[model samples]
Target: MKYSTSPTPSLNNYPRSTSPLPAPANYQPTTASAAVKRYKYIRRLFKFNQMDFEFAAWQMVYLFVSPQKVFRNFNYRKHTKSQFARDDPAFLVLLSVWLFLSSICLGLAMTLTAGKVALFVLFVVFVDFIGAGVVVSTLLWYVSNKYLRRDQDGPDVEWGYAFDVHINAFFPPLSLLHFFQIVLFENVLFRETFLSCLVANSFWLASIIYYLYITFLGYSNYGKLVDSDLPMLQNARVFLLPLPVLVLSYLATLAMGWNLSEMLMHFYKMRVLQ
Candidate 1:
């Protein structure tokens, strides 16, 4: 009986195991949950999860202490779109109240009449706070679209982002200086004299530089999404857009103050003559 040796069954032809495979040796089931918990804790600690008075206070303080960090860490696409200036009136309201109070304090310190105090408060809220922001952001949007195009097909910069940048950049310096003008400075003379105008202009110029710095960081971070290049020339172009806006705002505020002073002085002179 010559039985030929048969070849062993190939392993490839065998059916795969139906049993569930074990998890990998390095895999831990808690890793993802731990990461999520950590993220939520951070958000809570930083007050990013809530939009309230505390968050507004944190934002204002953080603007003065670590402005670059604020811009760098901010999710522009998420927050700018969702909690925009229009959506959240709390910040503006808070700002208006602050300016109103500051104006009242300054006017009282200067011994101004009731009507003058009311006028000053209105000017601070309407003109300095709201009006300046609108004008500057609009001009920035126009100049950015016109001169700062990354390429022919680059995305047009949104007005909201410009407004965001301007607010964050200008708020710190303006608030700090205004506070100093009220509390520290013996006399509150914004544009009454040449020295006062120089001081105010210097602060405004600082704000312009800070604005440019924050804008550069923002562009560098989101350049890819915006189709923008972070070249020096492009940065310079973006910087130039805010320059005129800042200067114009400064001049306009100065001119307004000067004219108000003149009118008041004229009225006082006429009263004295009587």
Candidate 2:
């Protein structure tokens, strides 16, 4: 359902205003309790052209730091998305395959190390998957709320909010996880299989750097490669830029030195494996 707040602000003839509007005293940040409420909140904001880079930036900070309000402000029952890319189950299947393959290869390598460090890397992989799950779910929820029934002056709610939350949540964990996973795989596998690990590592590194570049410099660089722009970059920044977050999350897992998988495996081996 399409819900409009104020009329669309003119993007074509945007007025040059030096000052941004001060946040209203009553304006408190919050998250949506359900996907539908989040949809309406974003839809209303985008429709009024209130959804912009500035708003997106703040939203990212709020999501992690103060999620309750962010969720609460969302008008749950009235929310709906005009379209959802994941509605195509084929795409979700492809994503699951890609994620599973990436995780397993890394896990196998870490297992071969025959040391506590290798075990640690395996734990990182598990956390990375969990983080990725959060990113995908949150973004999909927001995307479904976007009103694509008609074009407006600004981005749809999906573009403005979905990408932001996804990137912010996923990036840090994915990056750090990739590094350890690749390292363990290389050490365990013979020289022949090293090339596959290398290739995956390169892709992980490249995606992270690319994510950062697109954030600072517009995604136009991507347009250079594909001869067309990819909206993922712009839409994603509306949250925390998922790449960096995924990268950092990996680092955090490593720093903590918590081998979640090993712990679970140990418990299972003792309780069930025997």
Identify the candidate with maximal lDDT. 1
The residue ranges of model 2 lying beyond 4 angstroms of the native Cα positions read 1-81, 112-126, 130-156, 159-204, 212-274
> Each candidate: what lDDT?
0.54, 0.39
lDDT of 2 by residue, 145-226 (tens): 3522123453234342344334443443343444444555444323334354344444455555544543333221111112
Kindly list the per-residue Cα lDDT of model 1 for residues 88-131, writing each as its tens digit.
33454456566777667756755677877777677667786679
Q: What TM value does model 2 have?
A: 0.31
TM-scores for every candidate against the unseen true structure = 0.55, 0.31
